[model samples]
Target: MADELIFYTNPMSRGRIARWMLEETGVPYKTEIMTFGGTMKSPEYLAVNPMGKVPAVRHGKTVVTECAAICAYLADAFPEADLAPTPDERGSYYRWMFFTAGPLEAAATNKALGFETPPDKARMAGYGRFADVMNTLEHAVSTTPYVAGDRFTAADVYVGSHIGWGLGFGTIEKRQAFVDYLGRVTDRPAHKRAVAIDDEAMKIAQ
Candidate 1:
């Protein structure tokens, strides 16, 4: 059966991560762009995601919500692309993937709001704490060429996307590892293609 992909996205949201992964997978897909102020609240879109968030993917009958989940799902679903991590690497894969969604966002969000994590119980959080999270990220990215090591994997797609968006949004500083990782990931042909499409779309909108 042909894999039919319906990507529900809003240009200004986290959906961009999914978009980059889709391109990396090199699979053709249909896009359903939603607007703000009310388009997302429509009953039709809400039927797919009660949260009414963008970056949701409908592959055939399976509906995958959440950006990291969508990235893993697409890579797994399209194993021919060699983007999926091997069974041995699954643990580390999930670690960084969820780390981005869990701690990175928590730390970045808190930082954006001018709050800091208290040292006493900071490790209790999945990301440990803002500084810990940053340090952990720095270590992982600085020491490894990709998230899963020498060979690139789906985890890189998620982790790199976080780094990319973080640096772009000014939510995170342009550290060496982050700058280097973002440069490496964005250099992929698939990523370049994805950016071209998104860029054209933006130009047309303007």
Candidate 2:
């Protein structure tokens, strides 16, 4: 089958995360840039992903959508890249990956909307209220050099993207741990290449 990876993305959107992950893994992927009211929501795109979102991937006939799932999927599919955890690393891998997707993004979005979860049932909330989630994230990032121990696995692509976006948008508190972490990750040669290419494209489009 060629094992070619195809990506549907809008350079201006969250699909940028997938781009960076692709760069990190040193894997080649074809990009089909879509527009807001354009192919993203089309029936053709919807066949691959009912949600019709950016950051969907095609590997032959199998399609993968959702950024977290995409990151995990590609990591396994490209075993030579070693972007995923070993069997023993599953616990921390899934924990931090889903933490970025569920709690971190939820808290950041809630912060952006200026809505606060009620204190009474904060624990019941997946994000566990903003302060709790944010502080917990700060602690989590501080303790681990990477999300899953010393290895930089697919979890970093998920979690580091959160830290990068949160810091950029002022959604997260921009604590020192986040700042340092973002700095370390962004300094990576692959990340810089992806960011430079994407940033230049955005400037041209503007």
Candidate 3:
């Protein structure tokens, strides 16, 4: 018998990113929709994720948390999806993925909260200046058809989500490169399906 895959998430959270990746994998899994300040903080769900956060995955005995890690793990776990990068693609794959998860996420959140790192304190920040992070990210998506390379790998799933969310919420600048890159990566059946699922879930929650 094969191990069961379980996904814990809320429709209104980063779980949407994992939902897209799960759809891309074309695998059978179970979904648990957790509500904020409710089931999410329950002892049962807390056991799965100490932080009581949405977007955690449990594949049999193994548990994976964090959106980037979930994307990479799903790609590797279901090799048939071909979302994981090849040997040569590993460099860019890991590079952009981690960059989005760390610097990009930190910088965007801080900016949205109206907090900026001072010049002298920039050295202490992992993302440095907000402008620098934006410039580097624009160059990344514009230089290649996808973040990892010519192909759309798990890296795109992670990177694209951040860019898309940022653009949508006005957190990230509306650069031409960012808009164009988002259009390229999201024009897929899996993305469509994922959006539809989450949208319906949102309606229900409302």
Q: Please give the ranking of all candidate structures by TM-score, highest first, separated by commas.
A: 3, 2, 1
In the range 23-58, model 2's lDDT, one tens digit per residue, is: 888877787877777787899988888887787889
Clashing residue pairs in candidate 2 are none
RMSD after Cα superposition, model 3: 0.9
Candidate 2 structure lDDT: 0.82
How does each model score on lDDT? 0.81, 0.82, 0.94
Report how far off residue 191 is in candidate 2 (Å): 0.7
**Which candidate tops lDDT?**
3
Q: What's the number of clashes in each of the models?
A: 0, 0, 0
Q: Model 1: runs farther than 4 Å from truth?
A: 120-126, 203-206
* lDDT of residue 103 for candidate 2: 88
Worst 10 residues of 2 by lDDT: 197-206
Q: Stretches of candidate 2 above 4 Å error?
A: 203-206
